[model samples]
Target: MELTITSQKKTIQANVLQLHLYQQSKVIEAMDKRNNYYYVVFYQDQFINVVKPTHMKRHSHVQRAITNGISLPGDHPLVNKLIGQQTLSMTRFNQLFKKLQQHYPPLETALILSFFDSFTTAGSIPKLIKKTYYDFRRNGKMRKALQALYLLKEVDAQNTFANDLIGKMEFQKYNEAYQTLDIIMEKDPVYFEDICFRHLQDGIYHENLLMFYDQKNRHIDAIMVLLYLLKQQFNETHWQQLQATIQTWNNEAQIIVLSDLYRDQPHPIIEKELTGRLIGSSHHNEVVSFLLEQNYLPTQTEMDKIIDHLNHTDRSQLIQYFHQSKEKFATLRQSITKNQLEKAITPFIKAFLSTYSFEEINQWFRAFHESNELFLIEQTIHTMEKLQDDPDHQDKLGELYASLDQVEQAIDCYKWEMELHPQNTKAIQAVAHLYKEMGNETEAGTYQDLLIQTQKYG
Candidate 1:
């Protein structure tokens, strides 16, 4: 008899196990028990092995053909059918199983089940899954591995052994481990939390996690994780990068988080720096309101730092607020001294000047000069010099210089203004008066003639 072995689209012939059931019929009938009888003999490549009759009960035709000494190919359908029953000896079973595993699709559920069944211990299931997963992964067969993992997960939904393998496969295949994490989280949130904590503790996938959190708009959670990381490891460069990221967010949540961190950590320098950043952000008013509600009074330097970061309109508004608050104004004014007046107090003084009348500003200037604050007087003169085109400002400066006993300088100021505005009777007369004070009668007479000539022309 011949056995037809089909492999894919091809057929071949080989020697298969054959049994003479009639020859053993009398012995099988005469025996008290037929269960222990080995009725068939397999012949392959001049090698022979005995097979049990019960093994082929499911394939009766193949059993009858085997009883007639059939010839079958190595990849015969009967051979595969017999192997699929898992009734062969351990050595032959493993050899045939390995052959099928090597030739068949790795992700085929039947093949996977056959390979899994070959393992004697339940503990080895995870190992088999892991090996199969890596085999597919090594071959760049991500889809196959994912399918295998899904199967393994179905088998053991709480398989902690396969979690890491699945995670790695998902990460490599999808460039994200969250798919695996989500699955794990859904199955066991505590386990997921522990895994995440371990990853964070190991400093693994932190940046990816942060990016994922940001993409999901979980910035507060991301910041909390960053803070935890900083507390655990304290990486200066990483901390700075995190700070820069926080600043880029520049939202109310970030400000609140930073503020809470400051409250908890009590790092005044960091607090001030964070507050300065907040004041510079679009949520500046919100942050300020929060601070005020918390009864947090920023120091003069802190306020100045914030003011320096404001725009022109915001700075004006802030200064107006300061002007209205006597205590706040006093605190601002305490930072101003004669020596540091120009550098430290110029902005404040300018803001004040914008809010007051020119007469009021002049009164302040007179008070500063009378108090022997030479630096303040010099600053006032410098500010007035910027307005030299304004004859009124130039005249004011000239009178100031004359009051300081600077006769030549005052005279030069009037003459400079008269040069700019040749038709100004005030400048011309001032220059003439200064020349008379210096006892230069000829120069005074010259200016008086020029003034009369100007009047005649008019």
Candidate 2:
């Protein structure tokens, strides 16, 4: 005789106990009563232990099933106890009840049950949740816990779990929050609008991300995350709202986001609409910013629009904005693979130098120059050389040449320029004066000869 007990494997069974239980098959055996427990010989030759149907100790099996952390075992009293009790912390309750299994644990159910009990009585779950959040955060469990906690909404539980999630922002915990979101997006697959809303409320959303960039001011990560969000699907309202937000970002921070829409979106009509709405600005500074920050080489039509916009804005304001925007542009420009600056950076440098004095231009380039930002170094030198005729420009021009290891060229540049403008008495006297002061007797004698020669020729 054999026992069919596939699901009953864990009960105190060795091969010998199975043989003894099986040997009694189909016999009218004596019922042994030990304390109030009963045993019977079954047709399959197994000794079955039974408790009275209404007995309290039957709860041990019921509790076993419940504590196993699957669905509640049917009609069990411990179900109420498990669901009702707020006495145990989520972690501890799971440990005590054997819910925290070795592999593929019932973590979700445990967290939900604990959250149910925690939020069951409280009017304000904020502080508890906030504390729970930090605990999960500190333990590196936020990602696992968030997916579990998010399911509580499905249970129609009385808790503000989602709201609490949106409000917490420890700097150390932000990466965890980001990882949690990545998991939710992959696992749950919510609607486009819903994700957008969640992202917006999280304050770590796509368009509004640069506050961190400004705080950390590490523009590369900032722009990378910004681009990553734009690549995601956005519904109509969020798409437009984000467009407007990017438009204003372009205005305020000189960061451009909409051109990425063209890269990812296929519909020409959508592209045209984005072109008209967000990147349509004709202002040279604005257009140059869009081109430089986003690596967008404006099409001829776009270039025309920029030229037109420049007509409307004050030239001085454009110059001022151009100066202000270079720091941000340099931050992005340094990491780029291709030198897109030939058209974009060179024109801005030319425009900036053609109008602003060298002192003002140098002041604008000062931060990036000092930091030795690689992308704009050549452009800065070229712009400085172009602006060299300005009265206060000599020292900076000398500085630029000295930086290039062309110290002799720098000295000669000043001397030749003064020679070309001898009528500006300062230039003439400056050369004779500086050569004599420097004890360059031969150079001083040559300048004196030139002065005498000029008088005789006159």
- For model 1, the superposed segments whose C-alpha errors exceed 4 Å read 1-186, 190-220, 224-241, 244-266, 272-315, 324-338, 357-458
Q: What is the lDDT of residue 32 in candidate 1?
A: 12
Clashing pairs in 2: 25-45, 282-306, 282-309
TM-score of each: 0.27, 0.24
Tens-place lDDT digits, model 2, residues 402-453: 4443445455656666555554433444455457766788887887777666
C-alpha displacement of 82 in model 1, angstroms?
Answer: 60
CA displacement after TM-score superposition, residue 357 of candidate 1 (Å): 4.9
Candidate 1 lDDT by residue in tens digits, 41-127: 221111112223333342232343334311233322223323333222313434644654665555442223322232234445556
Instruction: Give me candidate 1's TM-score against the actual structure.
Output: 0.27
Highest TM-score model number = 1
